[model samples]
Target: MPTPVIDIDSLTKVYPRQIGQPARRSLDDLRLRIGENEIFGFLGQNGAGKTTTIKILCSLLRPTKGAASVCGHDVRTRAARSCIGYLPENPYFYEYLTPRETIDFYGRLQGLDKATRAREWDALSERLDLRGIGAQRIRGFSKGMRQRLGFAVALVGDPPVLILDEPMSGLDPLGRRMIRELILSLRAAGKTIFFSSHVLGDVEQICDRVGILVEGRLRTQGRIDELLNRRNEQVELVVSGLSAETADALARDALHARRSEAGLHLTTADAAAANAMARAALSEGGQIVEFTPIRESLEAYFVKEQAS
Candidate 1:
C-alpha cells in the first residue's frame, strides 16, 4: 500500500455553545486516509462536518480532539501547510485585484519572489484559460471566472496535495468540465487531490476512492474501483404505441413496469432481456422510445449509506 499523503486519526471537532444556540459536534472521531497521487472524494450532505473536517485539515479551525496530518507533518505545523494548496468552500478575493495581481499576491505570501511568481503565472494563466481576463478586475468577473482564479491561486506554489471544498459550486457545465479536466491533469502530473463535493457525478468520474461523511462522522470509506462491478445491471426500455394490454403483457417479463406519457417504462435484469421485450413490443406495433442501461452508481451507494 502507498503511504498516506493525508491522514486523520480520531479527529473530532465541537462548536461551543453560543447565545441561544446549543453546542454541536461538527466532527465525531472521524478517521480517513488518502494515498499519495490519488483522487479522494469526500462526499456529504450539508452540515455533515465536511467543511469542519476540511477546516481542520487546512489548520484554519482547531479540532476539539484527535489529530490530522498532511504528508507526514502535523496539520498545525507550517510544514504541513506548505505541502497543501487549500481552496475553501467559497473562495473570496479583493474585488479590485485583477487575476494577475491576485496570483502575484498569493505567490508572494508563499514566499515566491517576483521573478518566480511571474513564471508560474505564465503557465497557470494559459492552462486555466485566464489569458483574456488576466487584466480584468475581479469585481465584474462572474462566479465561473472567480472559481477558475481561485483554483489558479491554490496552485501558486505547485503544492503536491490540494484540499478543495466545493470547488465546482458556481461553475456552469463547461466550467465544471474545465475544472474536472484540470484536476485530472494535475493528478497525471503527480498531485494528490482531496476534495469534498456534493457533485456525486464528478466524484464518480474522477475519484479513485471515496469516503462519505454523515452527520459530522465518516460513515464509510472504500475504494471506488470495482465498487459497482458486482452489482446487478438493470436496463430500462421505454416503448411507445403499446396498448394497455400489451404493456401489461410486457410487464410480466420485466422486474417492474410503469405507463407514462412517454410510453411504457419497463425495467429488465439486463440488456438481453430488454432487447427481447423491445422485439415483443415492436411486434405488437409499438416503437422503441428509449433503451438505457442503468448501473449501480455512486449516488445510489451514497443514498444507501445515508439510509444505513
Candidate 2:
C-alpha cells in the first residue's frame, strides 16, 4: 500500500467551557489516512465539524488531544507546516493589489525574494489563466477570477498537499468547470488534495475516495465504487395491466413497491424475490413492463447512512 500523505490518528479537538457552560468536544476521535496523490473528498452538511477538522489539520487550531501528521511530518512541528497550503472558503485578498501583487505578497511571507516571487508569479499567472488580469486590482475580479488567483497563491511554493474548504462555493458552472479541471491537473502533478465541499456531485466525479463527516464524526470512508458495491441491495420491478386488487396484492407481497406511470414500482430487499414477483406478474394477467436492479447512488447512500 502507498504511504499516507496525511494521517490523523485518534485526533481530538475540544473547546473549553466558555462563560459558565461545559466544554465542547468539537471533534471526537477523528481518524483518517489520505494516500499520496489522491483527491480525498471531505463531505458533510453545515455544522458537521468539517471546518474544525480542516483547521486542525492545517495547524491553525491546536488539537486538545491526539495527533495529525502531514507528509510524514507531525503537525505540531514547525517544519511540517511549510509543505502544506490552505485556501479558505472566502479568501480575502487586498483589493489594491493585482493578481501578481497578491501572489507576490504571499510569496514574500514564504521568504521568497522579490526576483523569485516575480518569476514564480509570472509562471503561475500563465498556468492559472490570469494573464490579462495580472495588472488589474483584485477588487474588480469576479468570484471565479478570485478563486483562481487564490489557488495560484497557494501553489507559489509548490506545496505537496492542499487543504481547500469549499473551493467551489459561489462559483458558476463555468467557474466550477475550470476548478474541476485545475483539480484534476493538480492530481496529475502528484499533489494530494484534501477538499471539503457540500457539492456531492463534484466529489463523486473527482475524488478517488471520500470520507463522510456527520455530527462531528466520520461515519464512513472508502473508495466510491466500494461503497456503492457494498450497498447493492436494491431491486426494481415494473408491472402493468394489473387491476387495483392485483396491485394491492403485489404491493403486500413485495417489501416496498409503489405504482408508477408505466406500471407498479417494486423495490425488494431480496433480488431473487423481486425476480420471482416479476415472473408471477407475467404468468398472471398482469404485464411486466420492466424488471431491473436499481444501483444505489452516492446521495442515496448518504441518506441511508444518516437514517441508520
Using lDDT as the measure, which candidate wins? 1
lDDT of 1 by residue, 158-194 (tens): 9999999998887788988888998999999999999
* TM agreement with the true structure for every prediction: 0.85, 0.81
Give the least accurate 10-residue stretch of model 1, judged by summed lDDT. 224-233
lDDT (CA) for every model shown?
A: 0.91, 0.86
Number of backbone collisions per candidate, in order? 0, 0
Backbone clashes in model 2, listed as residue pairs? none
Tell me the spans in candidate 1 whose CA falls farther than 4 Å from its real position. 225-230, 237-251, 257-266, 270-291
